[model samples]
Target: MTVVTQEAGAPFGAAPPSGDAAIRTRGLTKRFRGGQVAVDTLDLSVPRGSVFGFLGPNGSGKTTTIRMLLGLVTPTAGDYSVLGLPQARALPKVGAVVEGPAFYPYLSGSANLARFDAADPTAPRGTAARRVADALDRVGLSAAAGKRYRNYSLGMRQRLAIAAALLGPRELLVLDEPTNGLDPQGTREVRALVKEIAAEGTTVFVSSHLLAEVEQMCTHAAIMRTGRLVAQGTIASLSAGLAARIRVETPDAAGAARVLAGLGLPDVRAGEREVTAELGGHAPEEVNAALVGEGVAVRGLAVVRPSLEDVFVGLTGEGFDVDG
Candidate 1:
């Protein structure tokens, strides 16, 4: 699918989204009280039907950027567009929540969605109802359609929020910390649902501190540090910047180093009982076979690639709770 991703100098919600580019932002900036720069000049693009993960550490401006994109907080500088609408006037088309999604405690899930339909006359009721039903089913919340919001668990409420976001037949769905309170099973379910939605040509722009989750679910990603975009690209391309790590659990570190030197792998470093270095096109199986052939008992061998969390840490010079 053609993706209409973020472009330079494009106003928020202006110009038709071409080639499946669902969301785009350029020079986006946001500042809060006390001179805290919540978001600095940042550029981003999300392709239609793409599961795009926005990754960063806490206070890295992930939430601030989402807020600006949804128009809840205006950017101090730069331009943005969502679903082909200019940010200046795209309020009617965008559906998002920067923080947690709020709902009436007394209202049932279906009733809340119906209320949304009533509020947005532009959303066709028949279409909205169908979308709501589909979303509920997708999120595994169909059984709780009649239950009040207050009775729903945290995960269920989050799913309801996702349903509400899907209610207007939106082509682009933006979520912040979507898996915040979900259990592992609920997280997997939501991740699968996100992929399914993206498969149907709807863009999914989601943010989270957990890089592992993003690595598993997202096709493309952007990394932010202290309100600035430090890295962005496909996973493979990003990994190319970091050195490949090889882990060998051997009783003889010196002997392994000598053997690796014979193999001519560059920048080999030895530590207590383990050695790491860039693998110059040699597969793990090949390395293990070579070691075993040399009478070196290879207890275990594993290749460690730079994870999305690793990328975030490399770019930010810091680390936080990355394994959500």
Candidate 2:
């Protein structure tokens, strides 16, 4: 694995700065009345064309930071840019579903999307109907385009909200908790739609509290804790710093442990039928050969890698609401 040099004073696991970031921030912050700091000074970089997951538990300032980025909320301090342009200039090319999806219950899905497209001064009136149709199709809602918003399923409703965001050509799409409050099927539908959108070369910024959602949908992720970014990088790179372990299942556990310890593997622990050790800079083949040479019967051997959950807990000192 390639080593990434940390920027001076950056939080643990932060990726080095990139020149082609779709979104970048320097000292971004937000403080509400009563001196409650919703978001602390944050430096973020999201690479262009990457599906970036902005993740944290509830009340960890994820939403506040997003609001500041979208200009819906003013930051107490710091600066940010979207698509290499200032917020105001970037807004026209950006589509976002913030907080949650809201629509008139009486309006059909297509009707709601048409209304939204008409409200955009940058959208061409001549392409209104085509845009609406295309947006509905993009979100897999064309079959139910005429369904009343009140009658749409939770998943369909979420798709309609995404359709609204796609009413015009967008360079970037921001979705905040797009799968929140949905059933398993709904969550899957939204996840698939997000992947499809990203496949078409749009940069997607997803703010989610669910670990599974980010793990499955995002190409890159940034973890937040207590209003501060704790880690940021490609999913693979984020976990690369952690050590993997090797497990040997055998009756001669003590013999296996001794061989692993002799090979300089750390944390060698022997159980009745198993021996495990951290496999830092050591090859599993060499360890296996050494064990066999020592006459230890190896029933099973496996390399256990650090998961995203492990990375999260290591960085935050807390577990996440993994499935939510």
Candidate 3:
């Protein structure tokens, strides 16, 4: 339930994360040519050792913000830090899979990974093969390590891209639409891999439009709409922020409505077989107590909590695509 606090300076000017933040941004904004604002005054805080979901519809500025975080693009204003360091300085500890992997069609998966590892000037000498093998195994791609990149299925290629990021140890992994173009089985596999990766104590920041997938996989979620953050918090807390509602099915619907109205509950509606009302800081027991006290027969009573989807819709005033 922690709300992100944006800060341009490290606390006490120590040049570290304010607390346990893995990624922190303050007023981060990006405007493309023609004065189109892609991201607007974004402030984000991603805690270390957490799987954070960056959620939004298409072209909601998720990719642009991520690009700024990865040092791939310059922000029009504001600043961000990664792993307690400036992004450019801390990038060595960050691994990212953005857009998708670009590999030579003729090369084997292992060879492709080797080339990626070799490109890192800080990598150790003569460890490329072992690193490549371990990375392949980590992503469940050992069987496809020797296969040509062109022959690999879309799912296998995606896994290989992740393997490229894992050539060495990393403190943060940023994945943008990692499940895009994946089949059901592939989606399941990648979701499992994401969980496994976070279980190892690495912080994962995944940008996805798949709200259901994010709901299931993330420890925390931040939602955006049209280049602005609408809500950000733990999933449970986000859901909890919405008002709880109650629906009572009874033959004495009118009587129940009258009782509920007398009890100071707002918006009590009487239907054919139901009297529904916003819980409005009242408990189900209180409603039942008052209704039963008035000789109303409560045939059935249910409480409907607002779901993450409901919260998102309430925040953004639109439904979700559920596919990223």
Q: Which predicted model would earn the best TM-score?
A: 2
| Predictions in order: lDDT | 0.75, 0.82, 0.82
Clashing pairs in 2: none
RMSD of each: 5.8, 4.2, 5.0
Clashing pairs in 3: none
Candidate 3 global lDDT: 0.82
- The positional error of residue 300 in candidate 2, measured at the CA in angstroms, is 1.0
Model 2 lDDT-worst window of ten: 1-10
Number of the candidate with higher TM-score, 1 or 2: 2
**Location of the lowest summed lDDT over 10 successive residues in candidate 3:** 5-14
Tens digits of per-residue lDDT for model 3, 210-254 = 888999999888888778776676788777766677899999889
True-structure Cα RMSD, model 2 = 4.2
Per-residue C-alpha lDDT of model 2 across residues 1-324, encoded as one tens digit per residue? 112223424644454455677888888888898999988778888888899999877888988988888889998998888898866678878898888889989999888888888777788989999989988887788999888999998778777888888887788999999887778887888899889889988999999878777888998988877787877888887777577889999999888998999999988889999999899899899999999999999999999987777767666654442211
Evaluate residue 214 in candidate 2 and report its C-alpha lDDT on the 0 to 100 scale. Answer: 86
